[model samples]
Target: MKKEFAVIGLGRFGGSICRALSTEGMQVLAIDKDEEKVNEFKNIASHAVILDSTDEVSLKEIGISNFEHVIVAIGENIQASILTTVILSELGVQRITVKAQNDYHEKILNKIGAHQIVHPERDMGRRIAHNLISNNILDYLELSDEHSIVEVKAGRKMKGKTLIDLDIRANYGCNVVAIKQGKSINVSPMADEILKEDDVLIVIGADIDISRFEKNLVIDD
Candidate 1:
């Protein structure tokens, strides 16, 4: 069954999501107050409307509650974002995802019953910074304030060493969740599986522990 989604705000983040979801064959209703923004997405989305999302009447008129998931991606206007989320919650929207500007915004959205909160800018900044600092670190994701998941290339020192021999969990307090070799991925790799020099390890642990493991694992040529 095809899922129905509503994306409000029509800013870069919201507009991109609407286009992507529509491309994936999901029914998407794109809403924005700006006529220009709505017109831009008219050809891409299932439906595009120019209206104030904070207005409960307008939301109801568009059948917003019928959507399986609704994304509030208002940028710059914190008040509008909060109000929209509150109205959606009150209307009994099945799932609501909100883009928050800061910690305070996230707290209010959470309190108002937002199902998910995304800090896209902060997450992207962290990922870019991590990639810039370490050449061996391919990617980084902040799972929480204290924990992270990272992808790091296996160093020469780690070549031909089985998971039991490395004992990453016992030594570095991190778990190797997956191994990426060429185009193939081995998720939940066995302890006896050997790692090659070019293998990429997807590891998850506390930030401090992950930092420690990265420093110890990567060696300059």
Candidate 2:
């Protein structure tokens, strides 16, 4: 069955989620106090409404608590975001994800029982910075403050080299979890597996170790 989702605050983050969920065939209800924003998602989402999400009465009228998941993407107005999150928690919503503007806002959201807190701007900045620093790094996923998983394209140094010959784990303290060649993915790649120049390696390790591996192995040109 398709999960039901309600996205409050039809800003960039919320609107994007609404459209994505709708595209995946899930039911999405888009809400915002801005009439123009609400109307913008009318055709994209299952339903769209202009309402003040911070008001408990307004939320109850729209039956917000019935949705399986609710995303509060209120931008700038931290107070409104917190209030809306508090109401959703009190109403026993199954899951509530909120976009936090800062550390203090995130702390308040956590205390109010938000299921997940997203720092989209901060996370995206990190991803872009990592990509810029390493030309071979195709993508980066931050697992924690100290750890990350990165996808790096195999460079000339890695071409035709078997995993055992490279001894990557012992040398760099990073593990190659998978290798992607064109459309195929080899999960838990064998030690004898030869890496091709076009292969994409999915590696995981501590941030510092990953940096060392990228600098020593992955090349720009």
Candidate 3:
């Protein structure tokens, strides 16, 4: 069966998530307090409803807790977001993800047992910053505040070196988890495999370690 999902809010963040999930062949229930917002997503989501998510009775009526995953994307309204999360937790929802406005909002959501917390804007800003600072970094994904997975184009310095020669893990504390060349990806690449300038390395480690690796090998003068 397709995994079921519920997204509460029709703002950019929530709307984008709903669209992406639906595109992946998932059943998504989109909810927003505004009638217009709900109507906007009527055709995009499996079901779009205009309802106050803070009301536990309404959530129960709609069987929100039965979904495999629920995302609370309520914007600006911190109180409603917290209350909705609390209700979902009490109802024993399997997984609940929420977007936090700031640190304080995140703390409350954490205390209330939100399964995942997303700071989309802040994270995107950090990713953009990383990209701007380095030409070799193709992409960056934050696994946490201090750790990230990065895709970097192998530079001239790394072109002729093997994984063993680089000794990246031992020296930089980062792991080159995979190597992408043209259309193929080498998963768990062997230490003897030579790197090419055009190769893309998928590396994961602490931010500090990644920065060090990027500086020493991925960047060209």
Candidate 4:
């Protein structure tokens, strides 16, 4: 089954989403008030339209409600973004993800019923900072203010060590949810399995515990 998605506002963020979704073979409707932005995505998305998202009649005409997921990525125009979200919420869009410009904008988006709010610039900065701080960290996902899920690559200290020998759970209080070796992933890695070189461990736990784990095991002595 092909999943359907709609993205409103075709700036850098929305354009990226449009390309990524289309690349995955999903049906996407790209909408933007800017004609040039819409035209740019015509070949990339399933459908691209130039329309005012703030207008309720225009949104309904495009059948925006039919999409299971809709992203409000309107840039600069905070008023238009809010109005569009209100209409989407009233129309009962299943999932609404909005890009927030600031703290005040995020608060309004939350009150208007956005399912997910993304702070792109802030998030990217955090991710880069984490990668710079821990050389072995391949990826970092913030689950909450206090917790994160990180993909930590096996370093010299972790090579040939089993889960039990490392005592990851008891010592650092983090759980290895999966182990990735090349393209194959083991969701249920055994306790006695020896970690090989270049193995990526997907671990989830509190931020403090993850930091401790990195300090003790990931970095070189």
C-alpha RMSD (angstroms) for model 3: 0.9
Instruction: Give lDDT tens digits, candidate 3, residues 71-140.
Output: 9999999999999999999999999999999999999999998999999999899889878877888999
Best by lDDT, which number? 3
Report lDDT (Cα) of residue 10, candidate 1: 91
**Residue-by-residue lDDT tens digits, candidate 4, 1-221:** 99899999999999999999999999999999889999999999999999999889999998999999999999988999899999999999999999999999999999998999998888888889879986888888988779999998999999999988998999999999999999999997999999986999999999999999989998767
Estimated TM-score per prediction? 0.94, 0.94, 0.98, 0.94
Per-residue lDDT over 64-171 for candidate 2, one digit per residue giving the tens place of the 0 to 100 score = 889999999999999999999999999999999999999999989989999999899999998999889867889998887799999999988899999998898999
Model 3 CA lDDT for position 15: 98
Candidate 1 residue runs with Cα over 4 Å from true position: 219-221
How far out, in Å, is residue 138 in model 2? 0.5
Error of 1 at 137 (Å): 1.0
Pitting candidate 3 against candidate 4, the one with the higher TM-score is 3
* Alpha-carbon runs more than 4 Å astray in model 4: none
Clashes of 3: 0
- Extract clashing residue pairs from model 3: none
What lDDT would candidate 4 get against the real structure? 0.93
User: Please, what's the RMSD in Å of model 2?
Assistant: 1.5
Predictions: Cα RMSD each: 1.5, 1.5, 0.9, 1.4
